[model samples]
Target: MKHRLVTATLSSITAAGVAVALAACAPTAPDSAGAASSGPSDATLTVGTTTDVVNYNPLIGNSRTDDWITDLMYPRLMTVSNTGAKEAQLATKWGYTSPTQGYYDIRSDMTWSDGTPLTAEDVAWTLNEVKKDKPAGTFYGQLGDFASAKATSKTHVEITLSEPNSSLIDEIGFWGVVVPEHVFSKAGSVATFANDGKDGGWVGAGPYTLSKVQVGQSYTLDRAKNYPLVKGGEPIAAKVVFRVFPDVNTEILALQSGEIDAIGDALPPSQVAKLKSSSGIKVEEAAGLGYSHMVYNLDNPDLAKLQVRQALSHAVDYDAIRSVVLQGQATNDHSSPIMPVLKSYFDSSLKEYSYDPKLAASLLEQAGYTKGANGKFPLNFKLIYSLQDAVTSQWATIVRDDAAKAGITITLSGTDRNTYLAATNAGKYDIYAGNFAIMDDPVTNFTLAYLPGGAINYTHVDDPTLNALIKKASNTTDEKQKISIMQQANKVVYDNVYDNIMYTQNLFFAHSTKWTGFVPMPSDLLSIVNPVSLASASPVKQ
Candidate 1:
């Protein structure tokens, strides 16, 4: 098996792809899933994107930018394959040695960026560290049931779980980015380490290493000569430069002006016509694994009410936004965190908040809200989002405009990405827009966002019943039992509108003809420029 595993995600959980027409072509085509490039060799890749990595480590860093770079610089036993299933990457093979124990066949040739040999010891240490961090570790919620990882040898590691975790392969592969135990052991604190400035300071075993950071300009990554998977056949690009614009307009302009050879962010649908008209670039509509969600701040007294959250959910029209604003680039996904892609696990019976200003007003009134002299609801709150993102900016406006119809006064607050994340984590707003990449498993996705103390549980839901259901689902090895338990948890989330999910979006990308091998891969939290696909891309023959 290849080192990179196809991450199971909303895009290909089943035969259907990400959206409507996209879903119609069930049993997705192979090329659409991404592959190794057969294009020109020995080229440099320059990509334009909004935002830069705020933190070097993926463990604490939650931005798309951080993930993009870390994916390229880290080693994973497995990765999301094009088919959306667990496929091996660094671990050529893995299997269960017992009911609750497993082993990974770590690649013997893998080495860190600093030339230290990467062994099963690194993998075991990484997993143990992740456990030590508890639910906050990246992808830890998916594997919180694991007991420990012990090195059996230099080329193999054994994993023992506290209980049976059916999603064992999914959990380890998705979050277990191996860190050099030798290096981190002396750091004292992994959380405070800065792997930047000179040489990007971090050690990795992937195809590319962080070479330099030019502040707001770009993050330069140089291809590693001994990338195990690439070996004799290295990535066609010697260097991958990610230029930050912070604004999609600036990113698009850079792409069109030839200042950047590629773009990894979603191109606004309104500009699709203009981008398509250009002869120098080509745009492709590929399935994406991320979506925007409206989260009610539990700390806000007014928004804490179930009725207020439900009213807000009903205040905006999901289908309208998908139709008018998205320009047919999205799907009317039910607010359930589980994508319909997981046909069985998805709670198909759960109803979505249909747009009904009248019903929304009534719900608000029922929840103790009254229209004031100005004919608007007395309660007022702020809707926070990343102002720099084209989609978020437009989405905030759309929701604000529609909310006015129900006499709900929603003050729009758009700020930088870092600031937005900080506010949500601290629960400092009345309402927040959670723009996130979908997780491979629905149970993992749901618990991560809503279960009590779940790392990204911005709402801070404290229901014991809901949390117990999730815990039960997570610890089981039986698929039917897990699905059944999650069904109950899904109901609780819907009944409470834990996170007012907006809609599912297909990742939209446009690249200059100058680059030829990058293709879109399906992932909940990654873009077409996902490291797996990027490694397969190359510069065009000039």
Candidate 2:
């Protein structure tokens, strides 16, 4: 799910009403049930994933790889709990010294995999470098409100934000994953960071250490011997192999045949049903923080017209696609960009763009788009989607159909994900379809999408008013006030200027019935809780 800014404060715009209306069905609670017993003994877990972990170096790492490494190597001062609260991790306990400043008491038991004592300098160094190079790391943008970080003692670290932010602890909990500053002081760029993953430059203080890696096939990790959290201080399996697959189908086949234990991206509902019926395999369908949407490039001359965009939103049949392609497994979203299960920051008052073909035609006509001599709307466009993601291709087809009815003609273009990304960065598409991984916190979900130049803000929105609202939402430390302002901003984005939002997906992951101890996270994003927290859980006895 994509990260968004916190909805801190608002004037209670009419949009708040729509937010409340949508929250009536907001996804809550995980889907998979607890196993009767724990997972297998230090059995080397053979998990399957589709992509390569971009980087293993914590300071420069900011993807699924970070979540995987976070569990095995380094520890955070605090971590987002199942309930979305900042709970103890490396830090035993913490509290605020003032409204905008706080201190964390490190746990005496924490240590690096190398047996080095985990101290406050490591925390200070990690965060200081993040502040210096804010754009380098994915989550560093949140640190713009940070003032200074100081080590009061060997075990105590203090953080002072430039302004009040209620979600400061949540952000800090993620940002607190410390890195060995001593290692990366020599590496200077993103390329060097990529090279670090294979050369063992991607070091962490977690329970597993990088053992060996093959560029595309697999990477091996060994149980950290000095891990302070586990009972035995290491994994039962001496070596864990993370095998890579070319696509979801190949990974699913491996899982069915017992060649792999788990897969990352959830299987579609049809495939999930098959897994449920299988003897040893079990399907876990969790309320995912994942959201997929249609993106309209504002740079397109025709799409820049608000009337044309509205007509397209009105004509598109999201419900039909949700039923046919998604098998009713997804939910319709029309709010503060698709948010996760933490809490509904959805503004209830904004009007939902309902499907009305007649209205769509009228809006298109009003936008000065007329059918050309070829018996189609003069608008010639391309729907760019990833050829690799099957579900996105389905959405593109539905969109293509809806636009045709409105007298608009579209050309379909599908390319491999990496090539598509390269084209997208170079401003290549007229419209695209994709999903954003929602973070556990509201700010991380809302602002990250609408904020100018955010990681996923491919639309290139630069509205001064929206930017100002985002600034206030991030700068203010208070929760209630921040939420209000965020709601107001959400209204502007949803009603007047949003590109397109079709549906937010509910994730469904297929795992083995015998595997226990995996606490399902709301977001599709994965963590190493099994290795760290569930390592001691014993499997159910048949």
Candidate 3:
């Protein structure tokens, strides 16, 4: 049994190979799930994304820019394998003798892209740096319980927490990205450390190493030959070049013309529909674990009334958005805070709001928000959102029209990405729209958003009971107990306590049929992509 456990690497590699081969052949061959078509063997595949990689930092907004780049350049301590098992990436193995403390055995053979050996001290230093305060620094308070991490040996490390944390394993495995202490140690804080035009700050043990990076044009990655092809290692994609475009329309055109092999994250609904008719352009749709939610500022006495909030929730037409904007590609969320993929933990009893303007007006009227001579609600509120996408603008327009019928007048406001997040975080708006991306567990979502003074909690929710429940869940180690606490906490948040959820939309990416092995990883982290048939792509005729 110990031998079976120790050398599970081959079985892991073989399983990945089979998955890649099967995925590559599945589309062209009959009676199989529609994968992309066959291609001539090649090593380099050019990918198009909306954002460019100016910095190879993993702490960035979990953006596709950061996701695609970091997956190639750096590796985390422990990562979810292709088979969805908790396997070691830099750490050879990890075990917990107690809920508060866990020990990890580091791989002695693993080294950074610069050929420096990966030691436990590097992990310790990076973890410490992540906790320091600076602009856009510090993780959610769920990581607050982390007391200390110390190296026991050259190949072993131990982390001790202030309290029992059940989610520690998943949290460490997810957010605990190891960085080279040798390079980053010079910087006193993360804010002062500059990655500007230099690949020195982020040396990691992933499959590909950063070769060249040009701000808006392209970023190049080459295969890490020295990196082991072990269980949790990134697979070989000889050259992964990400081409950044200005907008989604241009990205779609580039994909159709065969200028790029694949494009992701910025694909629009109309473009996806157009791609359906084009021959040899394969399309894949999956339920993104994220949700595009409408947040109500319950801090306002007018908006604080549960019926008024519920009324506003029922005013907007979800079917219209799902039908007209989403083009029948996305599913209507029936109030599942946890994504459909997390079936075991998701709560189903929460009521969904349908388009019933009359019902909404009545609810508002019953709550004593009677209309004055202006035929509008006795109050005027401001709505704020990200101005980057047409979908957000369109959704805002629909909301404006619906709320007008209920005698509530909302002044729609738009801001740039950075400004939008800052405004929301400062609680400067009455209503907001944004998606929570890259969260795998319910703990991060519920705890961070609704807990008092929590970093992401824009709604200003201040329920002591909710706060206590969240703390209890975070400190508990038993899976069943934690899940029960999570369900109860979600019920408190979603069941007329704090906020409103719009609908969860489907994630769409435009790609040519020649590119094979594109599967939707529900986690927004695109680290584990296996572009196996990249070796078979047609050569650039230039």
Best by TM-score: 1
lDDT of 1 by residue, 1-542 (tens): 22333332222223332211110011111343343346325666888777778888655666778878888887777656433466556776665544466667777887887889999998888788767754244556556667888998998788887875556655676566777887666654556555553433667787788888887888988887676454243555788899998688888888889998878777787888788889899886666555678888887777778898889888998887787777877766688776666667777777778899999999999988789888899878888898767776887888998899999888998998878877776778888875676566666776678777777787888888988887777666567777899888888888888887777777668888766556565643456576655666655556
Model 3's TM-score against the true structure: 0.81
* 382-490 per-residue lDDT for model 2 (tens digits): 7777665668877788888887877777788988666666666676887767766545565655555657766566676777887888777766655677778877777
Measured by TM-score, how close is model 1 to the native structure? 0.89
Predicted structure 1: lDDT:
0.72
Per-model TM values vs. the true structure: 0.89, 0.84, 0.81
List residue ranges in candidate 3 displaced over 4 A: 1-44, 52-56, 60-63, 78-88, 133-142, 198-202, 211-213, 229-238, 298-301, 387-390, 414-419, 524-542
After aligning candidate 1 to the native by TM-score, how far in Å is the CA of 286 from where it should be? 2.8
List, residue by residue over 201-274, the lDDT tens digit for candidate 3: 34666656667877779877776655553222333346878888765667677877888777755456767767
Candidates 1 and 2 compared by TM-score, better number = 1
Candidate lDDT scores, in order, read: 0.72, 0.62, 0.62
lDDT at 88, model 3: 46
Among all candidates shown, the one with the greatest lDDT: 1
lDDT score, residue 502, model 3?
61
What's the best-to-worst order under TM-score? 1, 2, 3
